[model samples]
Target: MNKELEHRFVTELENNQNIVHKICTLYTNDKSSHNDLFQEITIQLWKAYPKFRGDAKFSTWMYRVALNTAITLYRKSKKRIQTQDYDSVIYKIKTDDYDDTEEQQLKLMYDAVKQLGDIDKALVFLYLEDKNYSEISETLGITEVNARVKMNRVKNKLRTILNP
Candidate 1:
């Protein structure tokens, strides 16, 4: 709202933009849709910034807001065409040092992840980000034990999707 708060919000958003980009990549299918989602998420974040009490870390709070915005908008944005290839995608689901075999496996895993439900996809994304159970729980608004249980289920689901 005010200049100081706006400056702080912009600074924080810039620093943690990767989180938003990653969410947009997973939730969107095409470049135009991805840009639209990113803009919507940024607007939502700006609108809600005034209420950010900073009780948790800025990134942590951001995860909640960003994920929520993605899930909400994704449903409304179903008109966007779902493209298959994301090679030019900005935030790819890739890990450094992945060999050819690992790269193929990663593609399979990414496809499986893309097919997942919103909460399950969020759980896997957080897990891949190396967020501990506590952080995943906090970000997803679930208890730690619930997070673990759901993660286990998501893993099993992914395994089934990948194998079959």
Candidate 2:
């Protein structure tokens, strides 16, 4: 890639690296698997970079590529298991910028989100990141109405976990 395009790609990745990590974590249970998924998604994004047009937001295009990569990539393990404690997870996710309570809530929420099916997890991840239904639909190749309905169900499931 040329210097300008390389710089643009780096800028985009830096801006949205969290989204990539979030998707990888949502889809993979273990750290090794998460890393693998992250690498795979990065490869897909880098490969798809040449085709990205400037019409949509860079993040929007990223979501499309990342979601597509997540859905289609296959790993040998499919079982969902919870091995990390919420407190530990919270501590790990915490940054200097994040409040303690927000970190705790995010960790708790991530634990509950792990129980959701892959597609539902995708919806919740997108929703939490403030992506609109239209954007979620486009990213996941689902209808907007379906995105809304699935998100409502995911929310209810989350509420049950939090309240239980």
Candidate 3:
């Protein structure tokens, strides 16, 4: 990549690094796995950076690439050991002035979300990030209607998990 493009990619990636963090958090069960996933996602993004067209927003394109890396490539790799015990993942909530009740509730929600299938977890992550159906569809490469349907199902699933 040329200096200009490399600079652009770096600047944009710095601004949007949270997107990668959120994906890593949602997909990985522990801190080490999260770090590994983040590194893999970054490498994948860099490798594909040259092919990025400006037709879509950089963040949107980043979401597509990041989600694809997390969902498809990362999972298939032999290095990842999938874990089902969501409670093993630690959520670092700064406890100074934090309400215990609220923190526990948030932990419960995260635990519930962690139990979802990979695709459902991605949908929930996008929804929680306030992405509209269109953006979710574009990121996941699913139809808008399918995104809505899937989101509704995920929401219902979460409700059941929380309430049951």
Tens digits of lDDT, candidate 2, 16-125: 99999988877766677678889988899888998998778888788878877876763334443446535435535546876689768887888898888778878888
Ranking by lDDT: 1, 3, 2
Q: Which stretches of candidate 2 lie over 4 Å from their true place?
A: 74-76, 79-102
Clashing pairs in 3: none
- What lDDT score goes with residue 86 in model 3? 62
lDDT: which candidate is best? 1
Cα displacement (angstroms), candidate 3, residue 147, comes to 1.0
Instruction: Assess every candidate by TM-score.
Output: 0.84, 0.75, 0.84
What is the TM-score of candidate 2?
0.75
Per-candidate local distance difference test: 0.89, 0.81, 0.86
Better of 1 and 2 by TM-score: 1
Cα lDDT tens digits for candidate 1, 1-164: 68999999999999999999998988876677789989998999999999999899999998899899999887766676656556555666657875679768777777799899999999999999999999999999999999999999999999899888
After superposing all C-alphas onto the true structure, candidate 2 shows an RMSD in angstroms of 4.6
Report the alpha-carbon TM-score of model 3 versus the true structure: 0.84
The better-scoring model by lDDT among 2 and 3 is 3
